[model samples]
Target: MTNLRFREDGSFRVLQMADIQDGPNVLPDTIRLIREAIRKADPDLVVFTGDQIRGYDPAYIDTFLRRRGEEPGARVRAVTEVEAKLRGIKRRARNRVNNRLLAMKSDGSNPDVQQTASTASTTSTLVYSTTSDPQDVPTTLDELMDETRDKVRRTFAGFLGPVIEAEVPFAATYGNHDFQCGILADEQDGIYREFPGCLNPVDSLEPGTFALPIEASDGSGRVAMSVMMVNSGDYAGKPEENDAQYPAYVVNPRGLDLADSDGYGTPSPEAIDWLGAVQSELGERNGDGKPVPAIAFQHIPPQEFYDCLKEVPAWTPNAVEGARTHAGHCYVLNHEICRPGSRLGEAIGCADENVGEVDALREAGGYFALFCGHDHKNAFVGHAHGIDLGYAPTCGFECYGPKSRYRGIRLFEFHESNPAGYVTRMLTWGDLVGRYSSNEVRVWFEDHCVTGAISMRNELRRPQVFAVLSGAMSLGFMAVIRSLVKKR
Candidate 1:
C-alpha cells in the first residue's frame, strides 16, 4: 500500500472526483475531462467518491463486440437501429392516441375511443420500459461474469489512465450503481486493488470503509491528518432497513414512479459506529491520544443536508425541489448557515432515514467536514450540527450534471501546520478546458447543448425524453386543427 503524507512544503492536495458512471464504452470527452483535471490539479492523491462504472449498461455486450474488433461505426449503427425501432413503436402508439382523441371530440360517447386510449397507454409503457433482457445476454453465467470484470477493468483503465500513468496513489468507494452489473461491492473493491496506486485496504473496517493517515512533512513519522472513505450502499431494500418509514413515493405522480423506490441508500448504522472506532484508532496512532482532525468522503450525502437547507416557495429563485416528505416544495441553501460559494442545482436526494450521522461525527470529535457526490449537480458546503457538509459535483459526463461550465471536480488543500484548516473550491469544466476551445460558438454549443444532452441515451432519462416528445406531438396536432378551422 502506498503511504499518504504531507509534502515537504507542508502542503497536501486531494482531488475528489465523483460519479464517473459510464460503461465500457465510456465517452471520449469524459476521458478528456478526467485527464485534463488530473494534469491540471496534479493531486497528491485521488479519491473516486463512487459510481465508477454504470453497471446497468450492456457492458458485457459492448465488451464482447469490441474484443471481436468490430468497426466502431457498425456498433453505433446497431444501437441506433434498436433505438429507431423503439421510436417507431412510440410513434405508432402516439398516432393511435391522437386518432382516438380526435374521434372522441366528434363523438364523446364512443366506447371504442376509450378502449383505444387504454391500449395506447399500455403500449407506451411497454415501449419505454424495453431494456436489455437478462435471458437474451449472449454469454453463459461464468462467461458473463468474466465479461463484466473485463468491462469494469477496461472502464477504469480508460478513465484512470492518467492517475495510473502519473503514479498517483488513489482510493475509491462504491456507489449504488456500481454493483448493478452482478459483481458485488467487495468484488469491485478487489478489482480496484489490482491497479497500481490503489489504497483500498485489505483489512477494511467494514467491507467498503477504510482509513488513511497523512503523515507530517517534517519526517516526524506522526499522523498529521486522517481521511476516511465509507461505502454508502446502493438501495434501501426495506423501509425498516435504512430507518425509512415509507417508500420513496407515497403519492405516485402520473401513476408512474420515475424515482428509484428507495432512492439512494445511506451508510449503515454499523458504518456510523465504525467512524468512532476509526477516530479512536487514529488517536492511538498519533501517540498524543488526541483525536486527529479529519475529512470524510462517501458516495451519498447524509440526512443532515436537510438541516442545512431551507424550504421556500416553489417559485423561489435558485430554489430546487425537495425529496420525500419535502417533495413538491423548493429549497435553497439556508444562507444563514451555508458558505457563500455553495450551490444547489438539484434537490438533496438523501435517503428517507436520518441516522443522526452528523451528530455521531461530532461525538467522535475529529471530523471537520464531510463530502458526498450522488446528487450530481449539487456542489455546496453548509455548516450544520457543528460540522460542514459539502457536495462534490459529478466529474463524469456520462450522467446528468450542471452545464459544462459548472460540471467539474472538487479540490481540498491542507497544510501540515494547520491540518484542520484547509481551503476548498470547485474547478469547473470550463475552468479547465475553455482555453483549448477553438471558438466561442464551439464552446457555447458544448457547454449549453452537447453537455446537457450527453446522457440522452441513459435509461433513466428515456421516459422523460419520451414525455417531451409526446407533448410536442400534442402541440403539433392542435396546430393542425387550428389551421383547418381558420381555412373553414
Candidate 2:
C-alpha cells in the first residue's frame, strides 16, 4: 500500500541484507559490519531477506565456538564461560537456600544474609521470597508457545535493533528460521508496521504481499517503478499442506518424521494468485499498456533458480564478479529475454520444489527481477526468461559459513530513467570491516600477506631459475671446501 518515491533525479539505492542471524543475542561484530555497510552505502531503502535470527539452533553455538580452529580447549573454555555464568546463578541459588537453612539451625539463631541479625531462639523459620512479582505470562507448555510470540519480538528487536534505531525505510520477508522462534510472519509484520518505515507487511489474513510504488515528479505527479514484496510460506506446516506443494514427504520411502524438504518454504499458491490479482488491480505500468518496470523480493528461492544457473557464465575465484549475462531460457515464463550481469557467492538452492510458481509469476509479468535469501551461501545473479534472479550473500557472523568468508549485503541502484537497468554490487564484509579497521596504526598486515609472499616466491622461481642458483651455490661451496682442506 505504501509507495516509496525516487529522487527528482530519478535515483534510488536499496540495501539487500540477507541471513543476519544475530540472535539469541546481539552480535556486536555483525552489527559493526552492517553498520559500516549502511554508512558507506547510505541507501534509500533497506531490505532484509529473512533468517535474521537463528531461532532455537543450539548447534550454532558449537559452530561459533569452533569457527576458528580445532582447539578443543578454546572451544571448551568458550562453553565453560557459559557454564561459569550458570554456575554463578547456581551459587546465588545455593546461597539463597543455604541462608534459609542456616537461619533455621537448632544450635543458632536466625542468620541474616547481611549478617546484621541478633535473633532470640534457635527455633527459626525458613521463608522464600520472589525477586520479581508474578504476573500475566506463566511457564507452561502452552504458555511457552504463547511467550514465543513475545520472545520473537525481542529476538527481532535485537537482530534489527540498529535498523529500527536508524529509522531506515525497510521491509522484510520470512525464511524458515524466522518462524522457528514461534512468531508467525503475520505477527512480526504487526511489530514492523509499528516502526517508522515498514512497507508491505504480510501480517494479515493473507500472506503479506504488497506492491510498493516508487514515483518521481515528472515536474507533475506520476509513479514510475513498482516494487513488489512477497512472502514465501514457512517450512513447518500441516502434513496435508506440506504434501500439497511438494513431491516427497515424511510418509514416503524414508519413514522419517520430517523430510529435508519439510524445512523449505516457498511463495504459496495463494501468494502467487494474490500477486496476479494485485497486478491486475495496480493496472498497466504507469498506464503505458506495459506493466510498470518492477522488482520483486522474497525469501525463498524457487526451483526455477536451479534452471537459471545453467546459463550463467563461469566465474574466477576471488574477484567474484557480481554481474553476469545469460541467454535466459530454462523455465517457462511469461517473458523470455536475456538477463545480464550477476554477482555470485556461496550458491545454494531451494530445499523444496516450485510447483509452477515461476510460471505463475511469469504469467503476471509485474516484475523483471526477483530477489531472495533462504540459502546463506549463494550470492549470485542469474537470468531465467527475462527475470533477474538475485541471491543476496549471507550477511551474518552467527550463520553457517566461513569465519573469514566475505559475508556482505547486495546493493541495488535503481535509476528512475532505467528502472529495469539497475546496477548491483556485492558489498563484502571485508569492504566494511576494512573501513572499521582502517584507522589502526598497527604495523601488522593482513594474514593473507604472509601467504601472498610465499606464493609470489614460488611464482618467481622456475626450475631453470632454481637450477642456475643451485649451480652457483654448489660451486661456491666446493671452493670453500677446497680452501678448508688445504688449510687443514
Candidate 3:
C-alpha cells in the first residue's frame, strides 16, 4: 500500500468505504477484501463513511421474549405488531424480487433462478440466526448492551485487524443506519465504557465532529494534512421543538435514538463547539502563514445557501401570481434533507444560523474539502462556499438495486508543491471477484441469489478505475441456467 502526503510536492492517500454491514456470511470475505484494499492502498488515513452495522430490531426481540415468558397478552400483542410489520417488509421485499425475476425472465435475460437459489444458500449460511429460541432474549438493557457490544467488537476486530496490525491511522463518521442499528445510550457512558477508543478522537469536541492530523510526503518534503469528520444524521430535538413546529419528525426510520429525541439529526451544540476549537487551534498556527489543505469527512452533504426574493406589490400589480410565475431559486436548500417549499426545512440547522463550530472553521479559511458517503450512488456536488464535496462508493458486495453502478473509494493527493490544488481518483472493486455464486440448492434455500443482482445506474463523477474483475463468471453461470429454462 502507498502512503500519501500533502505538500506543493507532497502526496497523501485516504481510504474511504461505505455501508459495510458486517453480519453472517458478509463479514469474513468483506473484511478480508477491506483489509486487502487498505494494505494495497497504504493510505495516510482510513475513513469509514457509515452504515457499519445493521441496527437491532426491537420488535424481533420483543417477539422472542414474549414467547419465552408465555406473556400472551401485552407482550404477545407488542410482538405480534412488530412481527406483522417485519412480515410486511419481508413480503414487500420478496414481491419486488419476484417481480424483478419475472421481468428478467420476460426480457429473455435468463432469470437465473438456480444461481439465485445458490447465492441465497451461501448468504443464509453466513448470517447468524437469531431465531433459535424466544428464551434467549434478555430482559435487561445491560444484557442487550453486552450482546451488542460483543457483536460490534467481533465485527470491528474482523474489519480492523489489517489496519490495526498495519498501524494505520483511521477515522469514521456515524451514518443514520449505524446510529439507528448500533448501540444506543442516553449518555456517552456506555461507548466510553465499552469501546474506549471506538469513538473518534474529536467525538469530545461536539456530538458529531472528529478530527485527525496527518503528515504527508511530497517532493518538497513532508507536509501536514488534517481530517475533519462530521455527523449529518437527521433528527428532532428539544431546541427544535420550541419553534412553532413542536411536533417535528423525530423518528428516523434509519438512525439510533436512545433518548427517543425529537428533531432531524443535526450536530449537537457541544459538537459544534469542538469543531470551532479544532479549527481555531489549527488556524492560529497554519493560517496567515502559508497555504495548508484540509479535508472534511461526513455521512451527509451540507446545505446549499439561497436568498428568498421579496417582491413589491407596487412593482408588480399581480404580485401573488407574479411570485408564482417567477422561478424562486434563491433559497437555502439542503437537497439531501428538505424538499423545495416544504415546511420541514433543512434538518441540519440553517447555515445562516451560526453553528459556532462550523462557522469557526469557515472563518479560519483554509482550502478544505468534504468527502462523504450516504446516498450509495456517487456524485460530486460543489458547495457555493468554495468547498469541494466528493461522495465515496460502497464496499458492500451489493450495489443499489440491479442497475446502479458505483463502488469505489476516493484517493486524494495533496501537496505543498501544489498547495492551491489537490487531485482525486476513484478506485473501484469491479474486477475483484466480479461474480459471486454458490450451488443450486444453496441459492434456493440459503442465499436467494436472484434478489442480489447488481445494479448499474449511476456513474461515479470522479476519475475511477476498477481493479477487480467483474463477477462475470458467477453472473454468467446464472445467465446460462436461466437460458436453459423454458418460459411458461
lDDT of 3 by residue, 192-297 (tens): 3233224365224543366665544533323365667777654444422333321231222122221233323545666655555665665555554543456777
Candidate 2 lDDT tens digits, 1-488: 45577877788889888888655555666677677778888777888877775643432221111111111111222322354455442111012233333323321334353443333233343222222434422222233334444555665666566676666688777766664444445656776676667775554435456667777746334567777777776553443444443334212312111342354556777777876666665565356555567788878777667654433222222221111121122212112322333433323445445566667668877577888887665666777765788788677765554333356788889998888889888787666675333222221221112222322233223344456778999999999999999999
In the range 1-488, model 1's lDDT, one tens digit per residue, is 77788998999999998988887767776777777888887899999998887654544332221101121111222332354465442111113344334434422345566677767665532111233554442222344456668888888888888889888999999887676555667777888888999999888866568888999988777888988898887665542342232233223211111242455577888898988988888888877778888899998887788888897765454566666756766677888888777877666777777777788889999899999998887888888888888998887766656666677789899998887688989887788876432333543443323211212222122354457777999999999999999999
User: What local lDDT score does residue 217 receive in model 3, on the 0 to 100 scale?
Assistant: 53
Highest TM-score model number: 1
The C-alpha TM-scores of every prediction are: 0.73, 0.62, 0.55
- State each model's CA lDDT, in order: 0.69, 0.56, 0.43
Worst 10 residues of 1 by lDDT: 65-74
- Candidate 1 local Cα displacement, residue 138, angstroms: 6.7
* C-alpha positional error of residue 324 in candidate 2 after TM-score superposition, expressed in Å: 26
